[model samples]
Target: MAGGAIAVAAVGVGWLLWPSPSGRTLPPARARVYTEFSACLLSDSSGVSGKAAAPVWAGMQEASATTAGKVSFLAVAGPESESNARLYLNALVARRCDLILAAGTAEVAAVRARAPALGSTTFVVVGTGSSAGNLTVLPVAPPAGVSAAIRDVVVAASERTSPH
Candidate 1:
């Protein structure tokens, strides 16, 4: 039994040391050259100055720092209504943002409603909600997760939307 145990241990260690079949070593970790992707953040009544939207804004800021792509944030400074939401969505599309980060239910609905007209821009909703084509809803809570989710969603969308 002891001899068998030794053999198993040796096999495990051997496997760990074994080189890959191709014999090509992995390159050192380096900063990635991400294709340029623009994003816009639309907040509700809180906008960027209020406590409610601060976490969301900070999260996006961090996400922007980690990527090579040019990411931006835009907070709607006025009260949120369907009409206002439409205006902001239209403006974001006009600004040529590939992704839109809608910060509340109102923003999500506005984006969802307008998604048909703007075919290419992907709307990533950062709060609890449902989504469809060109719209991805991520359930957000506690503020910190919002940033991480935003980064992940943006990265994934960038990969999908980028041409080969």
Candidate 2:
């Protein structure tokens, strides 16, 4: 948890399902409920080899259990590339993930660029700063360590994705 910086990208579905008035008689809003959600973690080369990887991965598992969500990790084989990061993120979107955690600067940029187009998915950028459409950039300091930061991001993403 003491190595390179980490970022996150997530897809949030709760807001989309929440009934907003389009000036039509939408059906009565029922309480939103989520038995489970799917989360995707995108990591670049630095993240895979960094000391923080194991702890961050473990934290994702723990977060999954705590939030009742299924988590998947994708470690891109090559070094960081914005285009590649976008490709990976698009792949996760195709899988219909509710939340995405992108763990690097490149990944964060990719998520930021693509987030607006993916309406239902909530993108959480861990180490970056910005609030673009559905993308939530968490500028969390790493003083508590990368794993803890990742844990918090995942937990928040899961909560946001959940139906309330």
Candidate 3:
């Protein structure tokens, strides 16, 4: 099965990257190279506040390491107004993030309004919402759905779906 192959590959990679006597893991014979993709998260002014936001960001961070991509976050500096969130979303878009993750309610609303125009960028709402061309929502029911969506995006990035 594919899972068995992946498990073997992971163990092989671990062996190749085993720690040295100096405590630093050694590089593999040929390092796997990935594209310069970036996944950015948009949250409220106080950073991650809600329960789902932290886990969502953690998933993104873990994916970033696998894909050699960049993971960054921007918290709306003021109130959680849709307008304020729009400004921060604009900043992330300008940075050419391959995927923009909307965490807070205001951020998700702003993303919904703006995602139509930014059709080239994929926007993923970490909670429940509707889907557009480049925008999709992940339900917050079972925690695994969120993790699976995050994993899906990592595979997407690895497949060169990034708008980089």
Candidate 4:
């Protein structure tokens, strides 16, 4: 019985230390994936929209490098104008993107309007509403380290609103 117990303990430890099936000490960071063959990136003229897309594309690129597939990008003008929004969305649909990265409130609204026809495509929005399907909303607020900046803005707004 003691010998059997020792054997079992050795087996458990061996399993715990075993490398993954790929024979690597660490698992791969990214997996190969398939989608609708294009990614539509919508950003506003203020450039915040483009900034928001950077991290996502970087992560995807890293994954593609480590895995067995490729990723593509298609960017469109996402200015505050409704006309620009319509043009951007139409172009994205024409490109047949499987994912849409909407960078602002206006872009989110425009994409939500056509999401039904988008048909299971994924939509990621930065700083926008929450009602659209397959839409993941990442809200942006002032960071904790920027409390002083926020206070300054509030004071400025109050001064403007208070009087002559």
Candidate 5:
């Protein structure tokens, strides 16, 4: 794994549900459990299928597996605009996502715009984005490096929010 970076914005700052051998897994489907921390994604209209977003999503799933965390995503609706992006971001915020991931240019921009006021809910912009306040930006890592880059972010968030 190579080519990874984590920058704090403004000089600051899952998918499967399967029980691991040590019980640190979230089942992909049936019989889900509260993972204590949830990381949600705000992707472009292309959603998970987009090339840029897929690796990030995969990294997120890897993190979920390691942290026993929950992962979910919402694809932005058509007509890419900040206003529309905000709606999706608001929905994720409303869901009380412990960490909100913004992948894709549009999604990252939306996160940057709203992150300052959101407070406490960590924002991760995975790609070419600027880090500020509560937002953290990660490089568009290569396929081999996604897991390592994402593992740190997700695990840290999980530990910070987890009660047990």
Candidate 6:
């Protein structure tokens, strides 16, 4: 009986002191590259029309030009409606864009629906109230100063999450 007790006590202590499985350790995540190899910009005509579209397109052009590699911009020219927005988004995905900049809630929602299959692409939404699976939101307000504010916010956020 004494030997049996000793054996039980030894088994209990061994179990208590056992190390956790090394395989359970999480692998480090890969570093994300913010640089764009190819990009597509999609916006509703109502959100970006007439004089308003010119400045928005100009801003995008300037930003793309500043990047290290060449960037292409494709404006989804069609009727300003939710259905058209979805079509534009689908076309953007078909183009195999590395990054997509969509403007407005409907467009963002459309992009979100396709994000599961389009996981490799990054979507940046401006002035939108919708969320995508892997989409990054960068809200921009009008008149001029807001662009600078959004730029600063994006830079700060990128720096915080970027792998050193």
Judging by lDDT against the true structure, name the best candidate: 5
* Model 3, runs deviating above 4 Å: 1-34, 142-144, 162-164
Tens digit of per-residue lDDT, candidate 3, span 1-164: 99999999999999887777778754667865656788888988667655657767777867876677777889888877899999999999999988899888899899999999998888888666567698887777555667667767755764575454
The residue-by-residue lDDT of candidate 6 on 57-83, one tens digit each, is 445554444443223445556666557
Instruction: Give residue 102's error in model 6 in angstroms.
Output: 1.0
Worst 10 residues of 4 by lDDT: 145-154
- Over 4 Å off in model 2, which ranges? 1-35, 46-56, 143-146, 159-164
Q: Best candidate per TM-score, number?
A: 5
TM-score for all models, in order of appearance: 0.67, 0.64, 0.72, 0.48, 0.76, 0.53
Q: Looking at model 5, report the run of 10 residues with the lowest lDDT sum.
A: 6-15
Pitting candidate 3 against candidate 5, the one with the higher lDDT is 5
Q: Can you tell me which runs of candidate 4 are displaced by over 4 Å?
A: 1-37, 46-49, 66-75, 141-164
lDDT of 1 by residue, 1-164 (tens): 99999999999999989999998888998875655677677777667555545666676666666555556666665767767777877888889988887776667778878886777778877655577787787776777776677777766766666675
How much is the lDDT of residue 161 in candidate 5? Answer: 91
Q: Which stretches of candidate 6 lie over 4 Å from their true place?
A: 1-36, 46-56, 77-79, 128-133, 143-146, 149-164
Off by over 4 Å in 1: 1-35, 49-52, 161-164
- Superposing all C-alpha atoms, what RMSD in Å does each candidate have to the true structure? 15.4, 20.3, 13.9, 16.5, 19.0, 16.4
TM-score of 2: 0.64
Clashing pairs in 6: none
All candidates in order of lDDT, best leading: 5, 3, 1, 2, 6, 4
Model 5 residue runs over 4 Å out of place are 1-30
The backbone clash count of each candidate, in order, is: 0, 17, 0, 0, 14, 0
lDDT of 5 by residue, 68-101 (tens): 8999999998878888899899999999999998
Clashes of 2: 17
